[model samples]
Target: MTNQSNNSVKKTVLVTGAAGFIGFHLAKKLLSEGHSVIGLDNINDYYDINLKYARLLELGIEKNEAETYNNLCNSKTHNSFSFIKMNIEDREALPILFKNQDIHIVCNLAAQAGVRYSIENPEAYVDSNVTGFLNILECCRHHNIKHLVYASSSSVYGLNKKIPFSTDDNVDNPISLYAATKKSNELMAHTYSHLFKIPTTGLRFFTVYGPWGRPDMALFLFTDAISKNKPIKVFNNGQMERDFTYVDDIVEGVTRIINKETAERIQSNKFYKIYNIGNNNSVKLLDFIKEIEINMGKEAEKLMLPMQPGDVERTWANVDDLIKDYDYRPNTSIKNGVKNFVQWYNKYYNS
Candidate 1:
């Protein structure tokens, strides 16, 4: 049975990695759409715990309450939203939460995210992306989850020289551990969808950015360094390109997939699918930096450097499947997107 609100079916969604960039935006979007949300995150110090706590505060969960483990904290602003401070790898506790929450949908966005960082700390990727994802699949297999949507990365395309990477392209040669883990997730999701008959969809997000974005991303890094009169690292000697999709656009695609009727998405006798969620236009790295400089009203000191290990030179996502299936339209241009991020950075850090 499903709850109906505001001419839409209101679902109880369990969104893991609720403190992360895409997760936070997705959670806010879900709440505004009248869905009941149960947010889960360990709030790891991958970048800054303060930023994570700040995002939670926006969702009406206090910092003091967000710090406690395994304790459910209800939202003060939205009665339909609640949060739990926990890791997905907590195999024992995760299942119990699934049993109690009556979650109709599961969106697993919780995973160790950096490509270079995965090379330095490989275990973190295995723990969170592999083992933790296994737990999510187990819960879905046991519990009658209506649909499971999870995050995959464009890095999974690895060293593919193919332009406009598509789901039909071969992804067997992931260069980094992070990419390998995400590819493994696609395989795992496929397995569960085939064996257990669980409907699952995975999104391959390409260079997501915008307000409340991760500090480690290029937009934030460049903005902060330029504002501080410091040099920004220009990788691949400023010869790279990325399909930098805005956060709101990515969230829109996600919400569409979440709310889509399961009966309409089956493919090849299996209820599994994968789509690329991206701007569909790859902008040059230097051009992206130029846009940031334009927004910040300052020039960036570029420290031209060789491409780092485990990093791809360019990423261009082919989002044709997303467009065909969900009417996913990523229309945010790099200019407006960078302007929005710069405005947010100035307000968030200066004020």
Candidate 2:
């Protein structure tokens, strides 16, 4: 763990889901610090492959060159970065990856993301989020990885009806399969930390929106529809609220915790911990829409819709622990975040 603060050590970091938004950014940051980085992903056409490729390109990995089937690595790279097109669900391939690389830190961000999608694709969620995560914990435990940081979600605090959800809140009542899987991840990590002494941190992310965001997220959906002069659906009759943490803020918070490992035993103390990485600022759906409108300088054709299943009425993370532990600060205002997102959207899509 000497490499924790020593930049000269240049430890290799494994970023699962490197082609994904958060993973891409975190990998790039590690590379910039002169640490060798291995970016792992199945590169499944879950969303637009182009967006994933664009993120890789930013990391100096080209898509045409990154072509690979299951259990194969494209071997594409920057001087400090390498990408492998491997799914975490492939337990066989996962341990091989951990054994082959001198991976000092492992960031598990590759789970099947999205709440509503999990409802329709329950099998995929269990496979990627549950089975896949077990594979990660197993690999990390055996590989002697220094720290394992994984993505948890605010959705796990389902039906709590609490303002600014806290880590102390009971999260056994997850409404969505996705939420349940994420909660399961935290539990699983805690077990490993207790049994095997594998230091782990699970981050409960709120609604993360920003430049180069996911296509399925509301930020992307609203921007796309408004720009095309199409009506955008407002779920829950525009009554929904979210603590939309900007991607930059989330990445910064993740980076802060990625280097440090909690060493206390779970039984003796809080060896495994979960922190809420959120904006700590909630905005109503209509207000969010208006912000997008202001940023895009285009009014959206409103399509007020009922509350969608598996969707929460509100999410606001109480980030006091984050601030107390790591001095976490989220600076992007909705107006500013939306503007940056809109700029990226127009530039990326040539709108």
lDDT of each: 0.89, 0.85
Clashing pairs in 1: none
**Tens digits of per-residue lDDT for model 1, 1-351:** 012233558899999999899999999989989898999999898999999999998898889877654553332334687888888998988888888778999999999999989988999999999999999999999999999999999999999998989899999999999999999999999999999889999999899999999988999899999999999999989999999999888998898888877865555465998989899988999999999989888889899999998888889999988888878888888899999999999999999
The prediction achieving the highest TM-score against the true structure is 1
The TM-score values for the models, in the order shown, are 0.96, 0.94
Clashes of 1: 0
Q: What ranges in model 1 sit over 4 Å off?
A: 1-7, 72-78, 266-268
Q: TM-score of predicted model 2? A: 0.94
Global lDDT of model 2: 0.85
RMSD (CA, Å), each prediction: 3.1, 3.0
